[model samples]
Target chain A: MLISSIYKIPIVILLLSGSLFFLGLYPDISTIIGGVALFLIGMEYMEGGFKAFSGSFLEKILEKFTNTTPKAISTGFFTTALVQSSSLVSIIIISFLSAELISLTSAVGVIFGSNIGTTTTAWLVSLFGLKIKISIYAMPMIIVGIFIPMFLKESSWKGIASILIGLGIIFLGIGYMKEGFEILKEGIDLAQYAMSGYAGIFTYVLVGIIATIVIQSSSATMAIIITALATGQIEYTNALALAIGANLGTTVTAVLAALKSNENGKRLAVAHFIFNMTTGIIAIVFIYQLAELVDYIAMIIGIGIKNYTLKLALFHTIFNVIGVIVVSPFIGTLVAFLNKLFVSKKQSKGKSKYLDDSALGLPSTALSAVIMETKHLYENAFGIIARGLNLKKKNILSSMDLDDVVADLYTSDTIDIDDFYNYWIKGIYGEIIDFSTKAQINMAPEYAEELYKLKLANRDIVEAIKGTKHLQKNLLKYTSGRNRYIKEQYDDIRKSLAKLLRNIHTISTSNEEDVIILLLSKSKIHAERDDIIANGTLDRLIRKGLINNQMATSLMNDSDYAYRISQNLIAMAEVLFIDIDSDLKKLHVDMGISDEEAKSIVQKKDHS
Target chain B: MSIKKFIESVKASLNLNKFEQKGKKKAIKRLLQKLESRKEILAKIHKKKLKKKDLKELREEQEIVDLQIKKGKKLLDELDG
Candidate 1:
């Protein structure tokens, strides 16, 4: 409470100060401020639209391209340029890094490319923003965007609508900004107050940094700078200084974001901070030389000398590219340094690995985080279930002989499954359910359906754990030198389950669709082998007077528990691993045996 | 025109409904190809003469794959319709 109060003080004071200044410079400043707000809102809409493209589209590209540093850099560059949201790209990268889906070095390379990619926005605002009557395009785009989803009714169409609306609003905002500056120019020639040399550059740079920090988007700040420059509201040098400051401001956001992130996240944030800070400082130091280079480029490209806005955009791109060139060789060193600096705290095994509040900004990242965390839960449950069955998980995961795997017991004593569940499975399970609920709000209908299935899959995991816990009680007691027939039955149950575990492990690891299909069918067949009642194996044991009624009851109940565990695990696997973005995913359910089909297969086996 | 009428006109002109079916058809075709090869492999293994239990499991797998191929073909025909 005290910390939050203290945090609000600075925000309150900033708002009050802004209000006082705005009061002095009313109406015109209000138009300008409102325009900035519209610009930010437009960007929010645009990012939201682009995020709808995220799912396997971006994940596949990043996965395919991020094997090497250069490949990663190009992937990051092209993706951000196309998406128009470096922050969106960054969010996904951070989420990926946390998932350990992409490596740290590759993530850093992508961030570098994104910095250069963001410069395209400056080019866009300079080239087209001040030229045409944006309002003409703006109004029609808004109308068209509003009507698209009404007619089409697809998430992709909604994404298209959002983008059109976003571009319309952005253009409209720029028009308002141009008008506000023209109005403000009559009363105050802000250019008259311009300072020269180092003093002027430093002051303008500081102003630029503050503007970017306030806006939380350097691209928006750059747009404002370009618009103001075109309207004769600011000198070119001062705009350049502001550009440098805007670059620096991104670091502050990264630093603040790092405060709450996990170790890998913090490391990535710090890498971002270092990259931006280095780029900013280099831009500041080479302001003059680079300004001349921009002029030379302008001449070569046929942009007029007086086109300060275009020059500023060119300068922004040049420095970022130069920064990338200078920094590329040192990425290895930086990664090593960052790894040492932000070591992970003694993280509890129960803590959610991928679920973080930062991921909530986009539906795709949030879903990925949940999926990754669920897999983590599956890993822990896999360990517990193996132990519960009195078999070493390693042996099940390995290419060991099945009889040998079952022969090597996991524990001589009864395994405390409830304790293991409390320590590992319970907390992470709660987090996934809670995170899924939050992610559901912004999700499209398709994404919502996926999330719903995920929740069911998670429930299946928990139930499987519970079933294992139930079966563990009898497993240890019966497997210990009991009646020979009951002992054989229990041993058979252990061997069959070990086979199930091994198949599930193989299914989880294999990518060949046919292999996955075959293994899944085989797993179902093995699970059915546990139904002692359906096959009358239990009845025969009782009829032959081999085991007592108490033993019969325990064996029957334990068999049901074992069977349920297999059913739950297979159900979970079908959702988690089999459901993918491929033709096999489409055919998997239909091709996969239904219960009746499995029963038929079982009946055939019994007859044979 | 009603919204539904407009939607249908747009969909009809663009043939957008066919896009998913096209992809599904392509997928089924690929799966059928793979399933055929799996049947061949299973047949090859049968000639090697496994033990009774192993032989039963292999035959069961072959049957399941055969059924899946049939299901795939049926789904493809329905899609074609």
Candidate 2:
């Protein structure tokens, strides 16, 4: 608490102190300050304008393109270059990571590309702003940008105008900073204070970091360094060190963005930090070699040796390219290392495994995810139902005869169905429903119908489990009692359910759909025949005096529960497993009997 | 009768005592009505000569209904035994 309170001292005081220090050092401090303010404002407008213009389309493109590492890297590079802000790209990558749209490795790849993308600003400033009187162009651009937005009706066109204005203001800000640096050069040459060793590199690097932290933009700091270099206010060596510092400093944006995100987001942010810092270290270590290479490359391309600003741009590009080359081979190891560094919190067993916010945007993917999660729910329900019937799941799923398994178990263990429902089924079931509902919006009608059927199938599975719970009480009582007839009847219920489960397991694993349909149809008929009400089994048992009124009543009720369990399970299986085949679905529609009709046929035959 | 006995009689007369039996009867009635409709559909399909494309569909439907009827008769024997 004490530390927090002490840290809460206003940041404005620090800013004021820094401004006063700069004011004492340079007479044109106001120009520099105004330039910085305008540059930051331009960055904000550019970010907002790009986001408004692209909307969700950029996200769709990101998702679609980021299938592999190389593609992800290129996508990241182009996106950041277009937006003119690596920080915006970094934040978007973090959001994508949080949503599970992109893997951590892919996100790291994008972050690497963004570092290179950010160098575009340095090239733009050196090639245009330093050589020409860019403020003249800036004035007309701002005028046209303002007028264009007013004439345009569409918000996206207005956003484009805002971007144009932002770019113009950014150039104008660079011009102001260059003018201020030129005046400061006459009064004081900061190059005189520049030392000639690693100390100088370290000091200048620290300055670069502080400037970027204050400005919240590495691109702006790079522009400043380039302008100072062009005016001979700072040495080339110090400028190189400053560029490295700016690279390291940009990770603060990702870290801040990841603060409100999930573990995956945090992992991506840390990966960004690691990539930049590693690249910065490598650049610093080989700074002289890199500068010599940049000069050679520039000469080969027919550039003058005296053009330090252009040489700086070449250095920026070369060092980042070297970073990508060095880091690309180690990505797998890096991903492994990152995975260990930011270990995710272990999810509770109740959470849905496949349903994530990212999948909701893609209709087909979301449908498959829901199906996977529902299958997970079914597995849990299967366990509950198996335990409730006092049969082992392994035996039920295996080739062992269910009748033998039920007969072998003389005593039925009591199961707490409510506890099972609460622990496993309820949370995931609710999530699947919620996810499917959200996924259904903006989807094609047929896909929406598919999702609706999946929802019903999930409901049926839960209902089957509930039916098992209802049957469990009487099943335990009658199976363990001395009444042979009731015991045999309850065992029959258990055997039938086990067989149904075994059939489903077989159909799930097998590839033959026709055989599965036939088996399912036969099982459906068997389930209807096994019901005591339509079959008059309860009435005959009552008349024969094999059981008393109370016992008969319990048996009849429990039999209905068992029959409903089987019916629901079969219905759920039909929807989940068989409905995927369009041809079979059409065939079934033409040929299959409705549930009501099936039940009625049984009732009519019993009456006859 | 005494007051408690009189209240019990009132409850029994209200069909509260035989609620399970009442529920069973209602279910059976619904099932019987559904079977009658299905039987009528089957008879109509048999009476009209179906097109070549629909003949296989009619045959498949008849097969499913036959399976239901066969299963239902076995259940009837078990119930009426």
Candidate 3:
């Protein structure tokens, strides 16, 4: 459809150019320029259309299967071969990968696969475009395609029709381009100059790289080289060198993409660069031998070596195939070495402070980074909660030991906890709250309500941690087993705390948050559990003789902390449900604790 | 390996490709139920006063149940993929 739309400009230029030819009127330089413009646009339109239509399914298949590194590489090569253009496949794969819709190792495989797949084009050009008659079938293909859309009802069928029509148009465009070149073929001395006087192998190779980079089509570069070869303007040796350069230069897009990505993207790009470089170097070292190999194959197959264009294309295909097969076993080692070389020191160390600011321009890519970062942060928080909860279970000798352990955990790791607390957590919650409130005001209630609940849950987690410093410093001091009941209360709370922490640790990865919320909502049960321990401690205090009022009060302080932690957690659950009014105070109130009671406890001293 | 074989391996890794979707879903549900039942039995056994030999047997049973759940989940993930 895109080609058909863009074909309008080209058709007009082609008509004018054709009229000049038939009327014996020599077309001006402008008409030649117009023809070139149309040719490029048609090629691009068809290529872009094919790319978009197949990209989604390709991504899905690659993502579903590429579990291991080897699997990833193999999938990459096969899929690219199926698609026909490594450049086209690479662009799609990189975009999906950058968006984290696919894994890093799999992207590497696809890169390898695309390199091998792209070689198929040169082989097709060499075998069929040179040997077979495409012109007869080309006309029929156009006719069938132009008429198919009239009968198709399904949207997908129409899309397929568009692709078929696009294919027909592509061939027709190629025919016109060739004919246009022929019309002016005899008039140009520039062709002879290009072959011998003006340029050599070095120049031709440079031209190939520049042409591929600019036209963004190595096939077009090959066609141009073939046209030169067909017209006897360039020697076979030089043409072969240009083909090698074109392969190296076609990797420009992957390299540029890496500039805007993290280490993984850079690593994939480096792998592509190394693959091309390795093959290019090998071909250069044994240029004549490889050329002779292509010649031998052509002669054995009875294709005959008359067409220099065909032979050059054959050489291009053969070299890539041989290179891939030879390097397949060592591809992993090459990728690792290249990754180590190209990936920055910081990135290798896993401290990628660089956010690929370029990602901000692309919302999908930025959103992917944000989701990954958020998941990381969530996992970190879960870790801390796990450690803190497990303290109650561990038989730590002193409050100091528990405090030292928790403090050490917080201090370690490269993440800036202050930034994590102030920016990510607060920033995410702030946006959610603002959006929810604004949406509610505008009467877009459902999403707003959801956001509101999430805000409450997040805020409650912060509140749960608010009194942690005091608890960590004092809780273990109550372990004077002199009063058997107090010591037992300590052990029981510790065990329950451990169990609570364990549940929380697994909860985030859990398939259903329903279980977590159910567990959290049993806040009243937690309160009962705390009371049983407290009552047991009081009975022991009365029985075990070493009891004082101060000791009794310290035991009460521990009970209050348990009550408060459970209340905050319950608030978090209600908040998750989007219960807007479920604050810390409201939760405490629901747990039958007054504001004064909570305040008085916060001010209470450490009996230890 | 040939590219074709590699692609076949990839296709084979997906859980949905291995079993009928309905059967796979039923299997997951059954496994989850079995796991829950096993946990309840272990918890009950842990709280009871028992012979030392019986306690050791219960511990072994717990290990076996844990392994069963892990193996089942691994296959489930492969199927889901």
Candidate 4:
């Protein structure tokens, strides 16, 4: 990984100084540097276009296609080529793994494929970018890219336009780079610096690594290498070494990116590092042999003998493919080692489990992480509220009758609601809120809205816990007291809440929209029935003088607390559970039981 | 042709019109089938001579399902239109 602490700035400055020193000696240096900058900028634009274009398509494809190791590798290869960015592919894979949307094995497989897929850049530069009249195609592509957006308002159109523009700019940069190397050749041949034998190969490999590290882009470096090799500025053998070095250099970026990621991302980073290191070494040790093999293949493929650019591209691809083939069989062993290498620290009850910084890289991943973390928060809140009711969580989640659940007290003594809330609710809620705030910055509008709803659902969960804390005080006092009527009423309160909890548990697990909706509607009706005043339970008890004013007041206030708990939990469930399907989401909006309908249902119950 | 026009032609050629509408209709039909099955389950329970509480809850569930089916059918008709 790139150094993150105090040494980072100095290394960057030193790399810049070294790059400038080589360029300072030549008049064409400015053009070379400018071309690199343009290449990097073009890469950025292309990555942005692909990301914008993907929306949900890439995520769905990645999820669907990564069911097996080979399929995952192919998916990784095809996706990276299509988007023209291995880093972007890596980022998405990291986010997906962090969100638990894909397995670590599948992620590593894709990373392997992306290595081969990335070789396509070298082929592109050698075949079309350098061999053609760059400006002729570049200008028209840039023009058409700019013009398409004017007439088409769709974002997808904008995405296609950006892609055209990015490709055009990349071609222009290669053209400029080709010219810079051509001019530099007249002053002094860079080929003279190329070392012979192992000494030269090792030296150039180190130079390649440094070049890629300095440029912070292996793709740009590869383009530079290919253009220079094509222009005969550097010998082909040194270019091969540099290609190996460039492969090693990209792992530095992956490692740095993974530094901010979760354990899955860290494991994948190590996997990437291992893959590249192994490939680099193997390619370096057999460089001459590999070169001869490349020549034999090139002849059969009809490439000219002097076409070192195409040969280098072929070499770049061959080594990576060899790396994949060599290392792929050991992937099972590698995954086992990596899994043991980066164990997720055993977190506390209240710690955020799914809100890691990796998922924040993508809007969908961020949203998925927040949703999952919200569920974790809900589980914690569920335990706190159930304990507040003095009901065992296992019993409530079970198929046990609600009345039986009420009788099955969690403990004989009063539970500390405050302590449980602090232990399981406070820290996680704060982290989710903080993570959501950071995540919403780059989120699409609809995703931002979903995050907003999840935030509210999180709040609703906390509010229910608070309501439980309020209800728990009188609940313990009255349920254990000598007054049979008051005790029965308290037990009734416990039963009502247990039923609500049980119904939500069912809704949470059920995918059937009808069942979820019906259960949610039934819970709403039950919540309204909890209104002691509206239901005449309070009036009748008071009229009979079954309870004193003091008891009555306690009963009234505690009933309201119980009612609030049901209300909050139901609202949270509606948001979290109903989001399983888009159709269900629309149906929930259009046909969810309104408050008035709930009241009407309770009134009908009263009449009966 | 204009880029927008060309996109429209492509969409038409792909038969990609009203993709969401088709999905919505399919979802509604699936939900209606589930509700009908649920109704049948309830009807079986109603005939079993259940206790007063069970019967009352069952009656309420039936009413809710019937109302949902009516709404679903209405929504499907509107989508078709």
Candidate 5:
């Protein structure tokens, strides 16, 4: 309810806008909204068409070009610039990264590129293109975007539809904005006093930033700026300032994204912030120069680029491209600076939160960020598992309670391992799984498998984390008993588990496919160690007079169940490397006894 | 198409040259074999006049195999092209 009430503030502002328009105070409302809608829709349509046309090529380019930070940043920047929105680029990169389909560094570069990419919108708006009543263009785009799906069987056409509809919405908004501004021009005196103070420029700048932050769109902010300029309330100088502020303001996404990210996230945010800040300051230093440049170019070309709106947009483009050229070479230095600047505080160490819900729509990018976060968690899990095994106390053996260990093993551990199931994975997997029930729907079966592999991987990690937790609980109980061999056995198992977890960490974090397969193999070794734990614990129990005949039988049952759970999780990991049938057969046959048998094996051992 | 022939059609198209790497080719082949055998087993179970409960598992397996084949084929096409 609290969050809902807060959201109402924006809705209320939009409503009051209508009443203000009736009073003829805020001009260009219709054209502003219409242009925005058209621009957004056009951008979306163009992006989808381009992506569909170039998905494979893009993937390859991403694969080849995303090797270094600068390259990645430039790739992301250029891609978004070509397409006109960084959000889409961010979304694509995030999903690929989250899927472990791409490297983290590449994903980070894409995130930075997305910021530069979005600047294109401001430039586009400043071109005064939205003012031209591109309704003729809009009609054809709408028709193609809307009807292409009916004609084409490919799913990419649907993506095309989204772009087209997005353009339609943008144009519709621009048209509305134009009407709102015209009404204001005829009746409102509010315009004359609107810029009464020098402070108004700064206020407009801040307002531009705040509006973009609220809408999560810099293009929309630029559109509103254009509206102001067209209405005569705001001068070109003030509008230019607002445009600069909007560029800096849009960097908030990367900053918030980096808030709890690892070193890579912080680097991306810093790169974006520096890039925008540098451009903004440069633009200010040469505002008049830039104005003259646009005027001179227009005069030379004889195209009457006298439209302040068009000049502003041109300045935006030239400024950012120039800024990128100047700073891209120093991407490495900037990244290092950010790492030093935003070091995680000592008090809150090892808690890297990632893949916030804010990133969901950009599922790929969100997933990428979460993968980085998950890698952190996987490493921690590895450490815990290792620490559990190597705990050395001679008296730790004396505290051994084989009976309780056996009993608890029969029942599953109570710890919530789902913490390892990051939100991006869940959101993506959930969508795919939900899509499975669409009986008559034609869908890419590969889509489902992609989702399945992700789900399985996350599920595997959760189970492994739980396994470590279970091992820790029982090891603690046994080690405190002053049983030397039990203590040593516990320590050995801890070391192996830790090693296994570390291997998983390396595999999960690295984009290298071979490394991932190697990690899967290493995880499989945990199954063998688990067996050793069973046999060793049984031997230790027999030596301590702890295992009576009945206890021996129960111990066997406990081993079976524990083995099954561990294998189940391990199979999930191997699924990424191996096919389902082999994985399933391996789990059911080669790994150990059956799942049901394993469950009862631990129970029978506890009873014996 | 019958699940068996559908699988065979997918398998016959599994040209290794079409794959970019040995790993991918092997992966495709292994998955195809699994689907082929799983489908055969499921069909046999169905022909045996198995009860609904016994058939339930076969149904899931059949669906999975079907999915696996399609996915593999699509992947192969994308890589090859």
Candidate 6:
């Protein structure tokens, strides 16, 4: 509750207060803070731009490319490099993992590649930006970027323009940070504060982590470290430690993002944290040896020893590469370990199993996911209905005669239908409706229609449960009593409904389209013909003095409930289990007998 | 065999003629056919060999057959006396 209240404070207000505090403490470093903010915002814009331009397309590509470990790694590396934000890639991967679009092993592979891909920023800053007056180009790029997006009405063009503008702002941010650091060199020599050996590396690593966490962007932290190192504002060893810290800090973003996600998301987040922390520890342990290796590699590449910024980039790349190489072979084992560490809890009532935010953007996947979840809802409702009718689920689903199963049965224990609905049906049903609402955006008409039908099917399942809940009250009262006629009448209702459920189960499990359709139609007909009110069973019972007026009233209401439960279940089956195309559905609608006709046929039989 | 007796024999073989014992034999025959057809459709659906349109048509056909079987049984029960 406290944490939630803390989040309730608008982010803008938090940013304002945080900025105020920093401004008061380090008036001279205010520019650096502003630069960091701009850099982070720039990263957001770029991520948004990429998502807006190629969100669905990229998701498709991600699904296609992540078939194997090596492919997943390269895809991750390339996507992060393209977007210039490993956090973005990680979030996307987390979303995909939650959606079950990728395996845990493949998601872990992507995390490894993202770590390697993040090194591209360090390389870009060291080899290119520091070598030239990048701000000169940043100014024109920003102007052009703004103008192009403003003039263009197309979303795709606007997305491209946003990308250009984001890049320009990033370059501009780097220029400000570099200038601020240079000014700080004259005001205070941070080099004097830097401790000498392992202690210095440890302290600098901690500083790096804090800075990256504060900024929420490891790339921004890397830029600041590289810039400070270039101007001799910090020692080389400390900068390397800071680089390791930055790598570790990036996992914080993923951890926070996965907080509300499903179990898969949580597992992926833990895997990322472990990978980054282990790699950071390895870097710290072998700092000197790694430094020597970097020096040797720089010499071979003709980079001067004094070019510490590029050499720092080289170290960043090497350590991450080493981490990937060491960890790649054990990805399967790592996934298993992660699975054990974070065992998925049995699905409690109310949580959705298949509706993830990632699938919302993809129409077909969204449809299938909702269908699967609706089926889950039906299963829960099925359990409720079985208990409501005082029948065992196993027996109803078994090959045993439903009549025999329901015949000798008296009410054993009264189930709290309200409690069951609250636990199992309400939450998941709401989530499916919410997810479908979100998914309907930008969907093709046919897919939208499919979603609409799925939503209706979910409604029918819930309604069936509600109907069962209504029936349970008197169902318990009469079924367990000694009144032979009332008990028999109620038992008849139970048997009829149980038979419908059994037939639905059979149809759902059966693969033969012909059989499923036949069973579904049969269930529908039985539901229609078996109506107690239409058959005048209650009237006959009352007239014959077999049941009292009070008993007849209860029987009539409970009978209606039974009829609705059967009707809703059959309708749900039609929408969920039947895998017919739109054309055939239309044809079936056109040619098939209506419910009214079926009712009339029953009436005609009575008249005859 | 006369034409009427021959027709009676064929109807008896098909289990569609006798009403005195109710439609029990006819109901059983329809039930068995419906169950068999259901099995075949389920097999095709499992194999993923059936086209979507054909599957829809088959399912509808199955439903009609099921309704027929159900109504036949109900009618037979009503005629049991």
Candidate with top lDDT is: 4
Candidate closest to the true structure, highest TM-score: 1
The sequence of per-residue lDDT tens digits that candidate 6 reaches over residues A368-479 is 6788789888888888888887888888888896668896453488988899889888999999999999988976566788789888889899888889889889888888
Tens digit per residue, CA lDDT, model 3, A118-182: 76666655555434444455667656656544443333334455556555554544444444455
Q: List per-model TM-scores for chain B.
A: 0.90, 0.48, 0.64, 0.75, 0.60, 0.47
DockQ rank order: 1, 4, 6, 3, 5, 2
Highest DockQ model number: 1
TM-score of 5: 0.53
Candidate 4 lDDT, B55-77, residue by residue in tens: 77888899888878887889889
In the range A1-608, model 4's lDDT, one tens digit per residue, is: 22222322444355445457767666576567667766776776777677666745677888899989899999988988888888778777877877678888999999999899999999988888888877578889889999766655455667788888988888788877888888878877888877789998988888888887767778988999998898788888989999999999888866875676678878988999999999999999999999999999999999999999999999999999999999999999999999999987888888988888766666777877888899999999989888898999999999988888888889989999899999998999999999999999966566788889999999999999998888889889999899999999999999998999889999988877888989998999889988887899999999999998999999999999888888899989988977643578867866677878889978986887
Candidate closer to the true structure by lDDT (higher is better), 4 or 5: 4
Comparing 1 and 4 on DockQ, the stronger one: 1
C-alpha root-mean-square deviation, candidate 1 = 3.8
**Per-residue lDDT of B63 in model 4:** 82
Give the poorly placed runs of model 6, Cα more than 4 Å off. A1-28, A139-158, A251-262, A300-304, A348-351, A356-427, A434-608, B1-81
The better-scoring model by TM-score among 4 and 5 is: 4
Is model 6 an incorrect, acceptable, medium or high docking prediction? Answer: incorrect
lDDT by residue (A1-608, candidate 5, tens digit) is 00111232453356345445644533445444434444444544555555444444455566578888778878877777776656556545544543446665466566656656666765555454455774446667677777655544345556667667656656656656656666657766345655524476567667767866665557767777776676675777777778877887777745765565444445555666777778777766676677677677766755365577776776666677667677766666765676587674442224344433323433233333444444444444443333333332221222433233222232223333344334223443333333323311332343344444555565665566555545555555544547565555454454444344444445434553323433454355445546644446677777778646554554454355445545755565454433222323232222222334333434444465
- The structural similarity of chain B in model 2 to the true chain B, as TM-score, is 0.48
Model 2: per-residue Cα lDDT at residue B78: 43
Give the Cα-based TM-score of candidate 4 against the true structure. 0.86
Writing each residue's lDDT as its tens digit, candidate 2 over A1-608 gives 00011111233245335545777666476566556556666766676677556544566667788888898888888887777776556655655664456788888888788778889889989999889988888878778778665444345666687788888888788888898888888887888987768898899888888877665667778888898899998888889999988877767655664565556666777777777778889999899899899889999997799898998888888888788888888888889988897887676777877666544534555666787788888888888898889988887877776667786652346878899899989999999989888988866565688788889899999999899888998888888899999888888889888888888877666655445655577567668878877787788888999989999889888888988898888888877776453334433442345676567655654665
Off by over 4 Å in 2: A1-27, A137-162, A252-261, A352-608, B1-81
lDDT of each: 0.82, 0.74, 0.53, 0.84, 0.53, 0.75
Q: How close is candidate 3 to the true structure, as a TM-score?
A: 0.53
lDDT (Cα, tens digit) per residue for candidate 1, span A1-608: 00111232354345445545785657667667667767766877787777775545777787789989898888988988887888778777777877778999999999898888888888888888888877679999999999888666778778889998989999988887788788889988888978899999999989988877766678778888988898899999999998998888867766775687667668877887888788888888889999999999999999999999989989999999888888989999999999899875565888888887667756777777888888899999989988898989889888988889988988899879999999999999999999999999968888788889889999999998899889888778888965878888888888888888788888888887888888888788778856999988999999999999999999999999889988988888888887457667777766787877888888887887
Clashes of 5: 77
- Model 4, runs deviating above 4 Å: A1-28, A55-57, A60-68, A96-104, A127-165, A179-196, A256-265, A296-307, A336-343, B1-46, B49-51, B76-81
What's the TM-score of candidate 5 when only chain A is evaluated? 0.56
